[model samples]
Target: MIDHGLQHPVMVELLKKALVDEALASAPTDRSSTDTRIALQTGLHRKDVRRLREEPVPEGVAAPMVPMAANVVARWISEPRFLKADKTPLPLARTPRLGHPGEPDFPTLVAEVSRDVGARAVLDELLRMGVVSVSAEGMVLLKDTAFVPQEGLGDSFHFLAENVGDHLAAAAFNLSPDRQGPPLLEQSAFSSELSADQAQELQRAARRLWADVLQQFLMSATVAEQRSSSDSGPKQRVRFGVYFHQAISTPSLPAEAAQPARRHKKKPTS
Candidate 1:
């Protein structure tokens, strides 16, 4: 967070408040005694705890939590009407024909996902993120299978927070004594002293594995959505993802240094 410009004091205060809220929600104490319990658990003053609970959430303080752009991208890729014989998203015409019989144009595609948001607005956002591009023939093309905001730092940060936050929550729940069923899947592999070449190969392999896993999950989700439309059953939201990370340790220098220092050659007397 420090690297991301979330400074020490701000992060400390945020974590304190977060802990207070978590304690209130997760503790076995009565609701009326929540402030005291939260204060004790979070090491915050009771008065401050009460104030935090009573105060309204400040506007614009929270990150954007909506995934409307991502939803559109998902539908575009998975919906049969929007895909070609090869199961890839078809290049759409820039303009919309209100009653076209065949595959819908770009504007119609956006409208199908959300009528409140203008197609132009969605197109601009997708273009800015490099998820979509305009073809030479004036058609809009889907450049990526996912709606990842490449150009917007704020959007990227929001994604980071949401994905990591949920993953941690799942892990924490699995660790709790009260956890009921089998724990949500969590596993990792680690090794030290790997050469740079081996690390790169592992990174590439991880990416391929993640891509395959995501494709399977997406297909299952699309099928479930279709089946739910006709079946009378309760629905639930789910998020499935994969991540990879690599950290290299810095080598320590010896007191005498690793190599002898070169002496400067004396310049010829002018």
Candidate 2:
């Protein structure tokens, strides 16, 4: 859950226009890139959207963005959550250290939060991707970031990205969870076309696409639990990292013609 703060109305509107119904929704066929659509929705020049969307995935994308966002955005966009299971009340379970922006290792914290949510594996995939960063001190921290403004961020790109990352971190960890996909990128194993640099590029590209999905979602909440909390106070500042776990590639089996058989022992004749 996120705290939307006094800018709730603005954030919601941004969600509607820039995210869900972005610019490319109406763009002519020549340019339907999601990046272009984000530009249309956010009122950002296409150049601005390009900058945010095209920025490479940061050094430690896979580590723990949600943990950092949850802590950083709490004053602006979250509620402190104690780890708990479905049949148990969170307050009755374990509570994380709160009111501190220095974040916990979300994957570990989430493992402590809810195993059914698969937050740890989801976080592992993110670390494999190289988008979010974690410090040696075990703090879940946001890396330096660039932002793409849609309708309302104005000069507040990082603030929005941080919240966006926070929201996705929750979606992947705290809220309704899914397999979050290949948390890291892999080369075209089936194809030998990828050079080392090209494979790296693919990884970076995937991370951006994932982050874009997050940006639109955070701005779209209307009556979200966390947003309601933030709206009652002065907006808090936060940083975020959008993560995507790359799909684990499955190895192909050899052709039947190429298959090898084990030698069988001959039966003795009576």
Candidate 3:
């Protein structure tokens, strides 16, 4: 927020708005809560609550939490049909072959995720993001193991917000007073004493582990999506992710150096 130039007042307003929305959602739907009740819950002024309530909701501007290009890339690297025998993503033709109706290709990949969006458009986006490379013969290759976009600030920020927000949400749900079922899986490994080189090695190891985990999870999720297509019921989204961070810590004083000076026995000497 500081980088974005948002000030304390802006943060307060955002927090108040979020709290009010949460309170409203949790309240009984049969009866609408009064402005007083909302203000009490959100700690905003009654007038502010009324004004916020009356304000028109900005419409049709929301972006997807997960970009379609990302889904395409994930499918490319995870789905068996799109992967080589060695588990790496297979290079794909720009379009399906003339007679190969069921063959996996770039167009088919995008179409499976969303029919409304055209494959050409998605391909252009992936190209712009540097997620994929195209050959002179109209073949697409997955340059990155994941959709960590090298270009496009908007997509980068979108992933940052989506991943971090979901992570925090899981932690919050675990701490909620009325949480049900087992707590969402939220655990981390930490070790403070490590050389910088060791930290770098650990990060590389984490990346390798994440690659395997991502492939396994995506495969399961793809199967689940296919199985649930015919059923008419509520659906839930899940995000399982890993992050690694390392920083140098200030060195602490040794026990001998940290101890106070001992007083001399001057009186006994005299």
Candidate 4:
């Protein structure tokens, strides 16, 4: 927020307005009692509530668009045909090799993901972004597991909002008093007494595990989408993610709080 110029007061005002709006939405039919209910629920002045409701809501900023090249890289790493038996991405030939017309290659991978985008165009963008590299023999190697845009701050910010926003929303819903559905999956593993080496090892292990988990989920989701009927009901969206963070030390109580109270007699009653 300091970097983005979002100061404390601005954030507080945004939160206050959001709280008022949420309270209003939660009980739409209770509008007759809205001003009092919202004031009580959000601790906002009735005048402020009325003013906010009168003001026009600002339209949300759009999420940064991901390029087609990124999609090709994602498919390359996740699709089984493009992966080795060890589940690592296999180096792909830029074009089909002689006498292997049916072989899996870079061009075919791009075509499978999108027909309108040319394979060469996607490959060039990936190469320019340092996400992939080409060898002298025209074999393309995936340099990164994911298509993280290195040049743009907007894409990074968009992803930050998407991932963290959903995570916070899930937790908020789980803790809400009026929650009606089963809680979203929100669990983490912790080990406070870990050396730096152990933490590093765990982080690496988590990445490897995430790759497998992502692949399995994508395959399952693809099958489910193919099998489902669009006319059945409203469509749904889902996101699953994993994260690992290591700090120098685990959180602990402050020194004053951690220490026990000391007893002192009245100086021998002198």
Q: Provide the overall lDDT of each model, using Cα atoms, as 2-decimal numbers.
A: 0.76, 0.44, 0.83, 0.78
If both were scored by lDDT, which would come out higher, candidate 2 or candidate 3? 3
Candidate 4 has its poorest 10 consecutive residues by lDDT at 58-67
Candidate 4 global CA lDDT score: 0.78
Q: Please, what are the lDDT tens digits per residue for candidate 3 over residues 1-270? A: 888788999998778777777777788863668888888877889998887777777532224533778888888888898898989898888977632566688888887788988988888888888888889877898996877888766677777877898999999999999999899999999987898888899999999999988999999999999999998999878888999888888789999989998987766654
- Candidate 4 global TM-score: 0.74
Model 2 global lDDT (CA atoms, 0 to 1): 0.44
Arrange candidates by TM-score, highest first: which order?
3, 1, 4, 2
In candidate 4, the residue pairs with backbone N, CA or C atoms under 3 Å apart (3 or more residues apart, or in different chains) clash, namely none
Best-first order by lDDT: 3, 4, 1, 2
Of 1 and 3, the candidate ahead on TM-score is 3
**Higher lDDT: candidate 2 or 4?**
4
Question: Which stretches of candidate 4 lie above 4 Å from their native place?
Answer: 13-17, 20-64, 67-71, 93-100, 116-129, 136-138, 229-231, 250-270
Q: Model 1 over residues 107-174: C-alpha lDDT tens digits?
A: 87888777888778777777877788997776888886666777777678677877888889889979
Highest-TM-score candidate: 3
Give residue 254's error in model 1 in angstroms.
Answer: 19
Write the residue-wise lDDT of candidate 4 on 50-80 in tens digits.
8888789774442312547756876787778
CA deviation > 4 Å runs, candidate 1: 27-30, 59-66, 84-86, 97-101, 190-193, 228-235, 249-270
Listed in order, each prediction's TM-score against the native is 0.78, 0.24, 0.85, 0.74
Per-prediction tally of clashes? 0, 28, 0, 0
Q: Please say which candidate is ahead in TM-score: 1 or 2.
A: 1
